[model samples]
Target: MTRSVSALKGQDTQLNCLFQFPPEQTYNRSVWFIHKGKEHESCLTDEPPLHITINYTERFSLAANIKNGSCTLGIRSITISDERRYCFRFYTNENRWTDKGGVTLRVKATPVISELYLKEPPNEGITNNITCKVSNVYPRESLNIALCADIVPKNETLSEQREPDLTFNVIKTVVFTPSKFHHQKYCTCNVTHSALQQPLLKTVIIEFQYNSNIAVGVGITTILLLFIIIIVLLYCYKQTKGKGKAMSMSSTLPTNNAAHSENAVEAPSQESQTEGNIVNEHFEEPGLVYSEVEFSQKEKQNNKPNEDQQMHMTEYSSVAFRKY
Candidate 1:
């Protein structure tokens, strides 16, 4: 069993003393702490409060505050030379006992993001791997690499080795598939140790796939434009066909009207000619009368005829008489 604390230079830190005892033990108790071969012991007879005297070092300053159920010792700034082991002792009503071992307080330098590589920018429906390397760190187990809001890969593997400067280099790898829901995700690497009250953290920005609104908008706009183009083409085709039909009807109507006008002009002349022949027959004496129509002159008249028939060569007619 081992207890240890890690801290950075110029930072405050604490050693823990959480004592577990039997329920029956009471009335006679004592607690003490030993550091650098010096012991700060308490006496129950004198009613002196339990406390520890620290062997002050060049890196750690005065104690700021004692906290955590009076189990933790607080230090002001810590430095390189302050690295050492601390021991806690206890006594019950029966006898005295010590911890299995002791707490080792390590003064560590701040961790750094030494290297980072993204296999590729996040692509939808595809898995992406992120490799992060942390360097110049001590007590490598305290380093944490995670995604935003506890979205860490369950299978993440952490590996480390020592560097030439005696500091450690830690590597953490994560694998995940990107989604439209995670448009602007952040990946953070953190280190928490006895050196500082707050965890030291570094965050990396990453993103590639577009979110819901942008993706939806682009799809809808494309469909709308295609629909409009099809409608316009159909309208143009209908207009062209309509103009062709109108022109065909207009051309046929004028030829029909002209034929009807020529028939109207010839209709009056035919009626007048039939009426004259009837009058001449009524005025003649009763007899079998016959007449011949010929062109005596070589310069003959051009015939005026209806479109249905033609008058050519010679014509002969017979008149029949009846008693009135």
Candidate 2:
């Protein structure tokens, strides 16, 4: 079986090889070798590939199925020294001729910082920018870029880069203003490689402010003024209701006084009628002094009793006394 190792480096990298041979050469045995610097190091060679090293070993392994004519090489925790050309040799039981395949290994290192910038600052009716830069990236690989803003209408931008150690700047510009409704919003920048987008390479957050204190003060003042106005209006309403009640009492007093005065006049009239009745009763009694006096007076006047009796005695007496 013949196999070729891929040119890649990592903790656990798979080396796969696919091949086809004549049925007679089916008894071919495979041998995998790792060449470091200028020396050839034997890793594994057999009909069924063998795992050459332990788990703690920095690097070693090989697996082959001579029946299927396929083999694979697994290297654990690879290092820079492991980055080299690998060879796979296939030999038949009867013949000594061997077929070989080679592969070049490349190591990937941690990403480095490239660049960072701000597009714009948050302002009234203005757009702001947030940018990030990354370096030492793989060529022709998709890059995951994101821009985050703390303000409303959060926006995100994603793109790709196709070069080694390329500088990628993702700019997210947001338009907003400082208002009473807004919270403390800021801008964030993130740069990620497509292979490992979960862990970000660079992240930055920028805060923008414009007279936030003034806006807060104004809002507070407006609320206070409204509260005061409400209190004043309530006070005025209570005062008006009190005054209406007082005025209503004052208006009713005159009618009450007039009715009382009428009642007083009627009561005196009733008393005067009762006194006249008593005087008549005394006049009817024979041998009563009051009756004799009245009879003598009537005779001296030479007036008929029936005609004089109907006249107002109090008025005639008052006139007579005045003449006297």
**lDDT of every predicted structure (CA atoms):** 0.58, 0.50
lDDT per residue for candidate 2 within 162-270, as digits (tens), equals 4533333333344344343443444455546544536664455444455657678989999999999999999999999999999999999999999866744222232
Q: Please give the distance, in angstroms, between residue 174's alpha carbon in candidate 2 and its true position after superposition.
A: 9.8
Listed in order, each prediction's TM-score against the native is: 0.42, 0.32
- After TM-score superposition, the amount by which residue 119's alpha carbon in candidate 1 deviates from its true location, in angstroms, is 2.7
Worst 10 residues of 1 by lDDT: 310-319
- Candidate 1 accuracy as TM-score: 0.42
Model 2 CA lDDT for position 321: 18
Estimate the TM-score for candidate 2: 0.32
In model 1, the clashing pairs are 7-195, 8-195, 11-78
